[model samples]
Target: METVVGIEDTEDGKFEDSGVDRSSSALSSPKQISNPIVYKLVRVEGDGRLVPATDDEVMEVGDFLECENSEMHVVADTGQSLECISIERSSSGNLQLECSEGTAEADMGKLNAKLQYIEQILQKVKEEEKQRISCGSPVHSHLNVDSQCSADKFPAMDGKVQSENQEIPSIASSLNYTHSSGSIDQCSRPSEGVIESGSSASAVYSNLKPDLSMSDGEICLDKLSIRELHELFKVTFGRETTVKDKQWLKRRIAMSLTNSCDVSATTFIIKDNKIVRKFEEDSSGNLNAASLISLENMTEEEDGNFKDSSPVKDCGSDDNRVVSETRLGNCSIGYELEDENHQTEQRAAKRIRKPTKRYIEELSENESREHNPRLLISNKSTGHGHVSPTSYVRPAARNVFSEVRIYVTRSDYLGGSDVQIPCVSRVRRSRPRKDNTSLMKFHPTGMSETATKLSNKLLEHCSDAGSEIPDNVLKSRMPAKFHQPASSEPAKEKQCPTTGTAELRQELRPKRADSCSHTSDDDIVTVPTAKGGMRRKHHRAWTLIEVMKLVEGVSRCGAGRWSEIKRLSFSSYSYRTSVDLKDKWRNLLKASSALTPSPADDGMNSRKHGTAPIPEKILLRVRELAEMNSQVPPSYSSSNLAAGAGSVHGRDRSGYL
Candidate 1:
């Protein structure tokens, strides 16, 4: 048999459009035919085939209702049983239907029970709507509520009641939609008293009248989509929200529109440094301290918990109901306030965390290292501007040398008997100057001749001075004899040291054969180099005689043999080393190639300001020798010299000195 399932989507007693037409498939009510209880056909079965409902055919109420597919039998106008086929989803949303297939025989008892439950829901909705209309001026709504029932009482039970009716046949006995005291009087009495007799569909819905009491705003809210509700919510609240629940959005919007608090929003004032909430009361004289304190983290769905904690009264029934409702209202207010506050606290507290001591210490260390003057100076000096503290090795302690001591002496003048102060003598420790030649080790025998002369002179001087001599006088008389003499100076006499004497004598030594000495004529001074070492400052002008000697040595040794030339030909030129010979030869080669024959009667080229004063004849000689040896200078290749040598030989030799 084919089964047709229809669903009616309603909110706050108002029926929103589910796609099914009211006239065709919707259950036509005998009474109020113009405003029928519209049902959306969610599904239809034919020949054991399932046909899913489309948006054009069914209104979706998936968010509004949740149910498992099962057989639900509802009564029809013909007093026949119709089985509720199933539930499903489409591209639109959750499509639900509460309809019954036709049955000739229906249980009268079960039919009456189902009708009564539906009647209760419709009746409760109507009553709530009427209350809302009557209390349009919300100023009196909070205090002058006579029903003493919650506004959300019906909605809280709507889902529970529906689910129970579909599954449990004895749902009438099981479901109790009554509050502690107020609902017993307002809700229970109606179900107990009105044992409505007839099974006709007209009688069942005759009293279930449609409520038109909802305002334009309430009607508009029901028509709005989820996206529109979200926009409205953002506009009402200053921030956007992520919650997708439509009912929540609608309720929040309605409350905001009415300027109503979610739960009663309590105003807090600081009294004596402690937060205190203001007291609220309804028409009845009931204190709600317990409700406020206990509902700190409670939600609206858990409002039933308030009944257990309600104050037990030895008073009249009317008084008790008022008190109970007042407490419930207070709980609802607390829950909303607490929930919002809790969420805000969570978001605020999320990013905050205490830093570890080690982390804090590292920060302080870096800051100190960056700002400290001493560390900055050290880093700058080392050429490492900024570095990790761990990598920087602390310098060792420096020795603090004492300053020269000055002693004051007082003496009496011979004639006047007046005290005369002698000159203040400063006792200073003399520091020896560093010798550049001291780096190389030399044998004593090499300087035996020089040592003997220095020893003889020293002995003669010491013997001549019989009385104790002042250190200053003795130091002044001593000759400034250096350890080594320049190669230009005549060779010193060779004499062995007198090892037979027991007394130690300080003897001056002749420099080793390898060690060269600097002459006074040479502009030699120690200057710091870029790499922090010292080098000889060679700014002295080279004499014409030195150039001739360099040419003679190069001709004998060939251009590349600078060391052999230094030792053999230029040995007397102590200041000039093999490196200096090579450099001079290279310069001579450049000058020889660059110099053109010039008119000077002396057969010498006119000397340029920076060029060495070499005669044209000597340069011609250097080029001739350079070509003969086929040798390369410091930077020039041998092939280039051979090529240039041919050019030089081809030139006029009349300018030769």
Candidate 2:
């Protein structure tokens, strides 16, 4: 780099004849330049290295003399330049010149040497990273070390790590300037001293700037554009990326450069209109511990001894704890690898729940049906029992499952006592109505066989014991009066010994045992068989007493209140419903209107067919109630007779009144 300075040609170099004396005198005593021309100062050291000058270092025309072994001189483009000006002490304790029409070139060799030094440091960093990776150090540990190293080396940058490419030139330029509060002082150029002393440039370059301040070590990579970051990324990682996200690019570049798992801190991120700072995570304490361990390992590796590398002997007293920590680190690494693999391949699969019992049963049933339908059918038919092959008659398919009784024959117990031992059936769930109907339809033959077997057993027992049948059962077995024996009586009589077992069973078996005869004797009604699949409700006839109570109830409660009548009067007659009372009342009303009373008969009247007769007064009371309620058939002529009867009754009641 070169700097331009403007100067006035004072007296047109008038002291040329005595130039040597005048130049020596002007060099000894300097004067400030008083020209209206603008000048840019480039600081040239006594050793000949060039750097930019600050405002305070630029001398005015009348500054005082200050020099020690270093003299202020002017080197203008025109060889015969004007007078020398002011002099001042540079902060580095060297003399600086403020002069007219001066130009100088920056020392490229020194800058190149500085750049090489930066590259060497970067190379050392890469080598250390490779060594850490080779020694089985985790990426997170490397990141933590990088963070700490960065914080220590560039304490002023606030985690803002820039690429070496951007940092090297700045570092080289900053090398010439020493940090100071007032002004940047120029340091002595090493090449100038070595060259003046007749030393080789190699010797000068070998001993680089020892005075370079760590305070000037900041590199601002956050200001880099996406294209620059991409280039940096390629240079650092030897790869290419299509991602345009600035944060991701910066993070990738930083990680590649540092060989770490973490990015630089959020404070260093560039905030612009397009890019904004998001949430920041705090530095983990684990990272710090890992970093310390990593640093210790590196020191151990460098020293080539592992025994003395422990930093906290008292803390990690147990070797097992160290082993456990290593195990935990390995586990974390494994988990990270697994997560990466999962992400790279596809998302993790959802966990499945165990099948429910119903589902398993359904699945099993379906499998059985698909593979062996007959096995499923047999299992259901036998109700999970083993059916004997000899008696396993394949029953018709039923909608439900039920257990069947399979009696063991007498032959099986022939060697034992003659007393029969009943086979106990397994308890099962009650079949639904539909299942019951289906069972009846499916196994009618089985039922018939059961009935025959039971009858045979009873007959054998009765004959063997010579027990007489009950008189009532014998009476029931006797033929009805109208049931005539057919002409084939001899055939029936011939077959009497072998009559069907069902008929024999019915004839022999009484409904109740002798001990329960008392209950059986009380109004034993045999339900007449109906043709319908469902039996009809038995019709119970209303008695004279019930009719009298109903009439009394009607008189007290008025008519059409059968529910009230039934609740108050016929409460004990559970079989006599309110509907039955309503029906009986209707019949009584019709009978009252139809039956003409003979004047001789005033008491209870009986029908020709004998049944307990309802009293005439009760019938008359029912008619009176019906007439009073108007819900009955109107007996127009009977009303007149009723009035005459009422008057006659009134006349009879008059004497009592």
Candidate 3:
């Protein structure tokens, strides 16, 4: 070979060129193999091929060159090249660079830029570290394994964390961090500094590893200042966190306490659990801070289990033991306390005293009989020709005038037929004078007046004798003035002597006889026949006017014969032939008054004078009688008879008929 290069010399090579600067490879001699610095090739320019840059060639990592007519770049360091690494263009026009044991160094400018980028990254990391320290971490380097942070160290943290550890002693007296154990340990650090224990950090880190037991564990990463804790929670519980998880834990603990103890005790414990540490003393009676924290952690973890273990208990009194029966529709025994004994006595006194069989049968028979149809006649046997006492037969009148006598009974009378005794007096009838002139000198007008007076006197006697005129009879009488003919104009007179006097006497006398005969028949027509013959056959038929007149006269004087008339008869010859003429007249008058016009207007007035238009006097009398009858009690037999006879027969006859 031309000049063999010594491997030993190259192993510990040096640049010693004097004309060329040894400080940089660019200034070195091309043929001298001086110090060869290695670099990684990071980038290349377009269409560049990497060929071996000779010792004389100054090459950079991104330099383009031609090798064997192919484009390449300085892609690897000398060491990489020694290790058979190369960068070449593939058939698809892409560069393929590879190294076995060493990477190609970049160009000096690129390496310097990368180193500046790394310096900036280091600066950012220092800034983040400073921010983390200012805010507080869950763990710090200064805390002892068993010792916890001061109670006031973490002023913003919940008391639940502080209450987890109570055994830590004061160290950094000014630090305000609260240890998981609830003890108030003062430390020498500043009040604002947090001192997290190493054990807590380790525990937090260990908890972050995926564990199947904690798969369902929920974590809350809230406004807590503990960054590591937040991280651990995110890692352990899959990062979808909320405040609800912490609330759920608190609720479970509260529910457990409520169920396990009385309300007073449970509320006390729950409120205390938030601020004070609950501890279990060790065998040596020493409270370990770590043990306290562990207990609190265990409590928090087992809160759900504790709630499941305990159940609510009944706290009612003995009176509540009996189940109450609900009453239907508000129905209840409303008995008072005072009635309790009465009710009990009543219940005890109650005996099932069933009715006797015969009594029950009798009741059933009575009910059946009430439902059955009644028989109109009774069944009983009797001897031949023996009349049944049940048969009702009206007893016959015991005397000829018994019925009439009963009819005439007065208000004071009891049952008796008292025949009125007649006091006989004799009056001689004046014999018809043979010499008519002397005896007839008595004035006919005076005789007529005397007869009228006698008639009125007789009527008074008849009315006094208890023969009261019926209301129908009185109502049927005509008006008093109806029959009095109106006065006619006076006749002309002529002067004459004895012959004229005699002629006048004949004329007046004949006229008087005719008038007397006509009036006699007219008055007798109203009277009944003695033989019960037709009244019209034996008597003159009465005109309506005559009937009215008769009715008025009877109403005025009460019912009687002509001798008993109160006023002189306008027609003088009438006579009543019936033995009980007054009674028969009363009946006839009543029947005539009772007759009403037929519906077909039979030429008669429909209105009965007294019956339709009852006189005010009669109505007043009726009301008075009713009032008097009402005053009499029904229990008195005399009063009953009086009332019955008076009401049923006298004034009440119109209604009955």
Candidate 4:
């Protein structure tokens, strides 16, 4: 008989070969296999520390060995367990294992205690889900009914119950109800529900809402291109619209002109805006009168016709119109009338002319004729009018006055006794005489004999008195030597009696008597003689002492004439000399007197009081020596002698020596 072996049972409840042929063709062939199941390696430690395991290592739990390629559940050590629910192998050789539902392994009693502790947490999650879907609306309405029904039963069913009833070995097994081959089923699937749930969360983050029209209809902000929207925005609103206001204005404009026709069909007429049309019509009739007047004045000045008629009245006239004709012609006679009138009036007025040299000469001649006379008198005629009428006429030979020897004294009685005799005779110019004999005859003497006798007596008295005789008597008493007899024979025969010889003899006799009488009175004659002489009478000679006394007396009396001093008399000549000498002596004496010592007489000592006494002896000695020598010595040498002598004398003579 052949030895037979059956398959052993694994702890995961799968078949496993206990013994098999070695190196045989049967060993290479694939045997029967179960569906892939993934398991979860749950960490039941208090901390989340995991034991690292290698992909090639067979994970062993309490009594089971996890299959490397199958989904299984097994209990592990170190407070952790492994449940293999599904297995996946990537192209890169990465092994992925997923866990089954309700497959955890831990201390059963402790896990049960933790499950009781998490009872409130389960209830809170249920409350949150209920609040999320309040108002009888499900949060995800498009979710598949099977998946939602299964997920809804999780909170009511315990882990033990789930483990016995439905064992979801992996996330892939659980997701198989809604997916296929790792891709989500879009048809009859809940992907939109999931997406909408996430979208609601995103909308809360960005504070934005989806537009229902964009979802239901064919509209999307993201689908609209920038160029299409820009044109739409400009047409609905304006070209210059902002992004924020553009939407609003576009909506309003779309509502207003939604049916507007295209403007490209016909030519568009651009009518003026209301303001421009109004301004044009108003400005047409507007005119400033002042501006028009100013323009007229400007034209008048430019044409050189500032006084032209007002342009308002002449604005439409042809004469006032500015033409091409030259305006220079209008200024030709404008100022002629004023200039001609001035010239004509100027021509009618008279103008004074300056006189010529010939006229000046004629006037000068007339003035000369009026001022100076033609008749002129001579000096001879003027003298003739002053001549006396009773002047004598004499013969040609007797025209010369006869110098008769007649003696006329001062007492001559020619006119009267007191008459002033003509002591100085002048020749009279006589007229021509008829008889030469009468003219030659000497006229009777103008003095009478009695007068001649009295004059002789007077001359004798004057000589006796020794007084100065009058010059008139001396001249008259002298003889006139020239004589002439009459031209008759009898007058010629007699001598003329020697005209003044008798008179002289008689005058000489009285003069001799008067001289004899004058000699007898000596006092009278000599006193006058002494007065007339140049010599002075000696009363007392002017000695030096007397001269000094007089000077002192006169000085006390003040400056006066010497004659007024009763102490002395001086002759006229000596008196003047004496006065001058007194002045000189007083000056000399003042200098000498000032040198006298004071009563204290302390000249020998040094000037303890800072004062010097006068040196009287030295001054007197110097003066006496000067008189003897007749020369003044040098003041320095003299001053030394004076100082020495003053000292000696002051000691010798106490106050005076």
Off-target runs (Cα >4 Å) in candidate 4 are 1-105, 113-121, 136-657
Give the residue spans of candidate 3 off by over 4 A: 1-537, 560-562, 574-590, 597-657
lDDT of each: 0.25, 0.24, 0.19, 0.18
* TM-scores for all predictions: 0.20, 0.18, 0.12, 0.11
Candidate 3 Cα lDDT to native:
0.19
By summed lDDT, the worst window of 10 consecutive residues in model 4 runs over 261-270
lDDT of 1 at 116: 25
Better of 3 and 4 by TM-score: 3
What tens-digit string does per-residue lDDT give for candidate 4 at 572-625?
Answer: 111123444455445445544444456245232223322222234433533343
**Sort by TM-score, top down from the best:** 1, 2, 3, 4
Candidate 3, 1: how far from true, in Å?
99
lDDT by residue for model 2 (1-657), tens: 000010011110111101211222221111121221112233333333323345444332112111110122111101001100100011111011111001112223222222122222222232332343345454443323222222221221111111110222111101111111001000011111101111111122122212222211012235567776676555433357777887677555444332211100000010000011111110111122222222222223322211232211111111111111111121112113222332222112111112111111111111101111111111111111112122211111110001111111111011111111111111111110011111221122332112111111111211111101111122233132101111111111111112211222222111111121122122233445564333223233355556766766665565567877766665433334577788888888876655446524533344543434555665666566666657433344345434543543444234222
Scored against the true structure, residue 183 in model 4 reaches a CA lDDT of 10
Best by lDDT: 1
After superposition, candidate 1 runs with Cα above 4 Å error: 1-522, 599-606, 610-612, 631-657
In model 2, which regions exceed 4 Å deviation? 1-531, 534-539, 602-606, 631-657
